[model samples]
Target: MTLELIDIAVQDSQSHPRLAGRVTGHVRAVLSEMLDGREQTHELSIPVWADIADGTSQSDIDLALMLKAAKIVARLKLSLQSPP
Candidate 1:
């Protein structure tokens, strides 16, 4: 079945791993849903922001590590300190 092409993929030059991954996930999900079982011709390039993570063939990022770091920083900030 032939389908219509709508919207284009765009990439961000800026490299922010966490935010970029989240954005890429959303874009991929949308395209998958929109083009489900549809046949299309021509090449499509979706611009995804994958910082140095792209250096590796398999792009894998651990978001948990970022969260853990955040939590640790938060704890430090919350720790009772001498009143200034």
Candidate 2:
């Protein structure tokens, strides 16, 4: 199985200082869970980016990113468990 990180956007980090850490923690937890108890070897790449902008609270952004990560992990896990 292959894991791909499409995109990650963090806006106005200067305004909300904790946004970066929160997002990182969330993504890390998802990845940890996804990789736990797995025996197969796979390729993984995560490319992230940041930018300055406005709008959206930190909590909202965290929730969205976490959900997106969970969905990706679920899809990957299903693919790995299925018959080739």
Candidate 3:
């Protein structure tokens, strides 16, 4: 499976220079694991926003983001499978 992230917008998070890279890596990892064994390509262009606490640990943030992303992907799949 192939996943492409066009953009990411985060709010109320840490101000580290590597935060963007970390987010990208986390999202990629999440998608990779979720799409494992699938042979489809995915290209999502939705606006996903998050407001995390400044004091949140990196691990917590990563987990939360991954969970949210996974939920979003699942929902999209469901919608696509639904009949009009």
> How accurate locally is residue 10 in candidate 2, as Cα lDDT from 0 to 100?
32
* Model 1: residues with Cα > 4 Å off, grouped in runs: 1-61, 80-84
lDDT per model vs. reference: 0.34, 0.45, 0.48
What is the TM-score (0 to 1) of candidate 3? 0.44
Q: Which candidate is the best by lDDT?
A: 3
Backbone clashes in model 2, listed as residue pairs: none
| lDDT by residue (tens digit), candidate 1, 1-84 | 223333332322334555533323111111121245764444333334333344433224323233333344335435633356
Candidate 2 residue lDDT tens string, 1-84: 344444443322223355633333335321322345463433333222233235766766655655565566667768766486
For lDDT, candidate 1 versus 2, the one ahead is 2
Which segments of model 2 are wrong by more than 4 Å?
1-26, 30-54
Weakest 10 consecutive residues, lDDT, candidate 1?
25-34
Q: Which is the better candidate, 2 or 3, if ranked by lDDT?
A: 3
lDDT, candidate 3, 1-84, per-residue tens: 345333432333334454433333224322322355664444443333344665767767756665666667777556655365
TM-score of each: 0.24, 0.40, 0.44
Number of the top TM-score candidate: 3
Candidate 2 residue-wise lDDT at 56: 60
Q: Which prediction has more favorable lDDT, 1 or 3?
A: 3
